[model samples]
Target: MNYRNLFYALALAITANLGVMAQGHKGPAWLSNAVFYQIYPSSYMDTDGNGIGDLPGITSKLDYIKSIGVNTIWLNPVFESGWFDGGYDIIDFYKIDPRFGTNTDMVNLINEAHKRGIKVCLDLVAGHTSDKCQWFKECASGDRNSRYADYFIWSDSISRKDMEQIRQRNSEPNPQASTRGKWVELDAPRGKYYQKNYYVCQPALNYGYANPNPANPWEQSVNAPGPQAVRRELRNIMAFWFDKGVDGFRVDMAASLVKGDPDKKAVMALWQEMRAWINKNYPECVLVSEWSDPKKSIPAGFNIDFEIHLADKIYNTLFFASDDPWGAKGKECYFDKRGLGSLDYFYKKYADIYTSTHDKGYVAFPTANHDFQRLRTGRRYDLQQLKVAMTFFLTMPGVPFIYYGDEIGMKYLPGLQPKEGSRKRSGTRTPMQWSAGETAGFSTCKPENLYFPVDTENGKISVAAEDNDPRSLLNFVRGLIKLRHSSPALNNDGKWQLVSDHSKPYPMVYTRFVDGETYATALNPSGHSVTASLAHLGKAEKMSLTGKVKYKTGNANDKIELGPVSAAVFKIR
Candidate 1:
């Protein structure tokens, strides 16, 4: 079919399907085809010459972000923090970090973003707070009767010997150890120990335990006064931001709120309550969780959840493999061009999660985030291979979040010193390269003063250079995002079905159904060309090459021949 004819057919099909599925539950209406761009504020753009990125700096770059065809922006934590955990160790929830800008700057940012039709989502660190926070300080004052004393988990006085025993117990493989040695003893009048969720500087807040143990006085019940007070404070924080024009939040460590509940029922209930409050007060606001389990997080009222970097073998199989220079240890990822990885692991988990949450929420697939390496990292340095990965990411049936520099094929600098508690992840959080000039045009400040050094070795990858090249990864990603926005069959609510066998070595085939039309997509991540038969699945008639990939179709038995590191889409008329 001609391009014009195809457009008209799609429009009619979508109109017809909308009538039939009007009653069916889908995620938020605005998120049907929303493309999200994640920006680490400290690394995105530096305008004040203070060696750090700020809110005004982000506001100045809204035009560039909008040009990439993304409608949503997820900013990493900009709250007042000690910079101990890269802004995750928030010291004040209501204020923006001084390094980033003032609270007024954030308000201005939200205004400018909304003017450009872009929604802003701030990162909410709800699980813990910096040890230097006022609340934690108050709790650590040894005043048992202090109003904020129970805001954090505090245990009775423990001798040095007892603390050592607790540490030993934590070191051993004891699944029955109800209270692990996640505590630190404070030298104060009360002389109590407090629990920490992550680093020693981040103390876990008192959200209460799912199953309280009398032996551990710190394990307060969910209904306890302290837990109730914490819930109220969470609501207040959300309301504060919602009132300031912020559209939503991407909650950090969402699943770790409640302790000692393997089933996570209490944590789920806590979020449900928060969701209820959000719906009633800020109806337009949305909530996305960092929780990797969509089956549990979606039902708990999270509008979306990520499917990246969490102990999931399927996730590692698709992106991180043993041979990957940055990865710990594993087989080759499916897109490594090695033909050694299988999609069964990913497909099975995805199917189960999708089946359970298709009506309620979505599972996001980010190109990469601050906590993980970029798509072009390690052995997968070829831009063509990245195009294939982008094909799968953009065409999948969920929200697609592109990390700031992923569109430009940014490389993860190896062996960089840690910054703001970013140990190995420091490489991925490098400043965005806007040009090939000094400092990659990321900041006008001296190179030594940059928040994080730009990739200067072997010539930096800059946006200006990529903008001039039509075949560059930047332009290719822009094309995929534009296509996703214009096609209902590729939206977040589309139904996904695997057309090729999971055991296939190359040319992975899948069909996305939506608006009464079928969109078949094929990806070949292998080094050589390969043909796959789709006759057993169904007729995929109208074929079209999408992105920067190369492919050919055969009429005999509905087979498709895909070139190395290529991807294509078919209308399936």
Candidate 2:
């Protein structure tokens, strides 16, 4: 047989081994095992003098990310979009946003990430396009008799009189007519018409399937009218990026893709189609759905799991205003949102769990990203208290994501409220403060035009400044992440058992097991000492820690004395 024929034969064999014939359970293997880091490209770093972080900027920081041991990167939208939504509202899927970089820049990023064994996953906005997108404009203009006219959801028309009558019937006792209109006019020049709607800039897409005909209203339904057309457009976009070498996609607002469906079969079909198409062309590529709903199921076409229990876990405790472990009595710390639930409750609530991301409200302790406020700035936890949060998150069974600059204890100034530009770009998106340098070594752009301003006073708080400080929070986080990577029992998929629920307020203890190995982790939630018993477990091995020994196992002092909200990990044989 010729070499060409041999190549075809090998490809078929590889596909068969990957379980392509099995529809329900077969999917990519790397997903469950891989650790991911979310990158806010514009805020991560700047290689050019434009003061905006771009593709090269991310390329330059790969070493820093890799140093933390993550193998996957989930970047927020980098596609062409009006700068207002921070890249979520996409204008064009095929092109890169100018502020981020060019198409070639993205290709280069994929290449670089691949070389380091890291996968690149872009934000795929499958739900809605920015009102500025060309397709929306075409639909408004009635140009070329848009095949996409029904692709977006539109409300039926009713005259001003009918609207007024409906409002009168629904009016409150005060007779306030809040929504006194029926058909709202499209703001565009051609359509020059309106529809009663939601999120003026975002129009919903059609998820039904039928062809448009005056006799059939269902024919005008977005999905009913032309499911293939919409699917083809999205498929083409996915293929475009796949050919450019993106490893996968993290679909945006995925649950909204198919609205008003009881079984969720419409969206599930879309995902299944998208998944099937990608697997055919790029077998290794993964599709991660972002389903914000707590009851989210593994959609028909999804290769990896998505947002579920992890959201409430982090927001309700780590970043919530009620969670401050060290808040002054009668008044909570500015951001403590804990005690609404416990860490064990968060872990036990899910049958399956996903651990990190950039979409969180604040730094997801043990990991932080650029989308929210910096961890140091949002919460006032002392270093010791901070370590407990970190140890708990990093040592948990799934992948751990570390935001840029988090390892070295980056801080945003408190009370630096957000300004008119991109939401609060002022504080969290500031440049990586390497040292007390001019402009924190972030930009040559005049300080005023920068996407964000420097966070430190005289730039004193920086990576270089804290690197040499032995007691620095930066070093503490690094030590924890390094330790997590060192132990398979701590980092791998495991069965976690809650061993103690002592009546104490803060210091907590738990054990995790995987592959015949057991790990015991203890955490202190306050600044003072709190002791807990390790009485039940037999024959203890050595404990892992940095400072002088304040507690030990199996001794006359069998109590674990945690130092002022600190934490420690011990491996018992």
What are the RMSDs of all candidates, in order? Answer: 9.6, 8.1
Writing each residue's lDDT as its tens digit, candidate 2 over 359-474 gives 11111232554445556554444455455566666766545666666555566544454532344445565667666655676666666655566664565466666666767666
User: What tens digits encode model 1's per-residue C-alpha lDDT throughout 388-473?
Assistant: 89888988998999999999989887788888778789889999989876688888899998887887443447888888688888
Query: Candidate 1 versus the native: TM-score?
Result: 0.90
lDDT of 2: 0.59
| Model 2 vs. true fold: TM | 0.78
Off by over 4 Å in 2: 1-27, 143-145, 156-184, 187-199, 209-225, 262-265, 293-314, 323-366, 369-371, 378-381, 412-421, 424-426, 457-460, 466-474, 502-505, 538-559
Steric overlap count per candidate: 1, 24
The estimated TM-scores of all candidates read 0.90, 0.78
**Model 2 residue 396 lDDT score:** 63
